[model samples]
Target: MDKSLILNRLKNIKNFATDTELANFLNISRSTLSNWYARNSIDYDLLFSKCENNVDINWLLTGNGYNVKNESNVLAEPIESSRKTKDPIYELQRVPVFNLEATMGLVPLVDGNGVDEEKVIDYISIPSMPSCDGAIYASGDSMYPLLKSGDMIAYKRIAVERAQIFFGEMYIVAVKLDDFSTMKTVKFVHQSELGDEYIRLVSHNQHHTPKDVKLSQIAAIGLVRASIRLHN
Candidate 1:
């Protein structure tokens, strides 16, 4: 927010030691530079035109981008930072683990659809985990060894209405059956050879066979992001 600091950063990027040098580079008089410094006001037009590719307008205008020390790119930061900082940007997040069964009571909260946030019974803050909306305990042995019953799985909610997926990824799904029963379980959702109206649910265990059900049958869906297995 300090225009003077921004102007100083520009000076550092240009390797200009003094206000007179920067003023000459900006095609402005030293007095004009002093005037801007007095008011802490900078003419951004001169920077964009004069500096062009050398100035990283993002870092120049707002101190939001990476802090770079390299002279080659100057203000511009590479995709990857060679220098290491404290990584203050990364922080631990408390993901809500709901009481809902991984199979039955699983509700889509990624979009939070109609579900209330208060449904969260507990929070699990694990470092270096993917971002997710909530977590649920797997209800059945359908997924077996990979994701046994009672394993707490963090899930990212997704709109199951006209669901889009990268076939074969594990997901928690709520499906309405022909018997008017609702089934919620975690399984790999694969494109149904049965056609567009249906999706095949594949269980990890060999004993359980893949079943193709209508996409319309899926009432709610959540992409399984990470799982926590605890044994007593």
Candidate 2:
């Protein structure tokens, strides 16, 4: 394997789990996981399957920051930049659908667990990413103007970013400190007087109080990308 790929694989390992958790997830038993670490390298396939779709393999290997070409590359046009069909009225028929679940309480419109190919829902094929386990449904108005109750939100599992505060981007975050609940909203992370960092998960709606938390407390973070409102 190239030196860059090796590095990227290691970076992905860092995101998958704590050392112990990774060991458990791989079913390697602690001793074996330790052995692999001690050897300074791991099997390519073993590390590859463990990564979430959002992880940039190129970045992992050589710091190129290149995202893997999503599965859409083979069967469909590029997302976001796909051209509209010449015949606007020609709509695609029902596509296979999956029932997804939002383990976190905030976004409720997401499809939760279960896919029945015979029962197609909509035809918009979403390219799965390493981070994207499935879609989430919006549950509350906490993310009002940007997202509302019943709106389906696309979520991608991502490595937790502790230092950056993406002002407008919405995220599905597990606050490791306060109840460890997952909430969907805009967030900001700042420092406190005691040399600690605070995370503020906010709602666009003015009346809702922002959730303020400490950095050492976060468990996971998922970046929100797009959503589809089912209108009759």
Candidate 3:
């Protein structure tokens, strides 16, 4: 699809007056939208699902039909009926969810030439989260209220060279200690008094104290993008 055409359609939608508004309407980040524009590739299925009955699919796909559904078609439906419908499976992307406790052993399989698809214990479908390579179940209360145990966190892999951590952002980092590997949130990163770089792992629960870790101990890093919590 033409990038300009998609952007124009999005801009014309009601309440999507700004890029940020459009991103929110689509349930994605502004950076994700920027990346789409950069690649000139928009996930049209996701766009259509989000727009639902508000947009004319034919027009959206070919630019040859009315922008909105016909008035008669709208009136034919019961006024009390909800316009929302479940998105088709094809429109949703499935991501593998790995067990945090077992991820250390799984890392070698993932870092190999091919990921061992069998290592994935389960899959979660997310229609709105963008650029997620996989997900991990939050293990401890380290992130507490922000990310509780059992919450599924969508993440995107960070290249070794580009693994620089943003000071305040939450990240799923795999650290290699002398005896074992573990995943934890890197809450802060800064230089020490002697100028050596260090990262602070913080827990939202006040009972847990923050620990400093060296960059060299990190084996892999994934930027936490979106999270889902299941409520009883």
Top lDDT: which candidate number?
1
Cα RMSD of predicted structure 3:
13.5
C-alpha lDDT values of all predictions: 0.65, 0.47, 0.58
Q: Give one digit per residue, the lDDT tens place, for model 1 in 91-178.
A: 3556677866333335533221123456777778775554455688887788989988889998765545343466889998878764
How do the candidates rank by TM-score, highest first?
A: 1, 3, 2
**Tens-digit lDDT track for model 3 on 136-214?**
7777676777778878887755432222355566777777755566655534333334335566666667778877777
Model 1, poorest ten-residue lDDT window?
Answer: 69-78
> Which is the leading candidate under TM-score?
1
lDDT, residue 41, candidate 2 = 62
What TM-score does structure 3 among the candidates reach?
0.52
Question: How would you encode candidate 2's per-residue C-alpha lDDT over 73-153 as one tens digit per residue?
Answer: 124222332444211111211123223333333222212212333332443444432223335557777667767777876
Clashes of 1: 2
List the RMSD of every prediction in angstroms: 18.0, 9.0, 13.5
Off by over 4 Å in 3: 1-91, 105-114, 161-163, 183-196
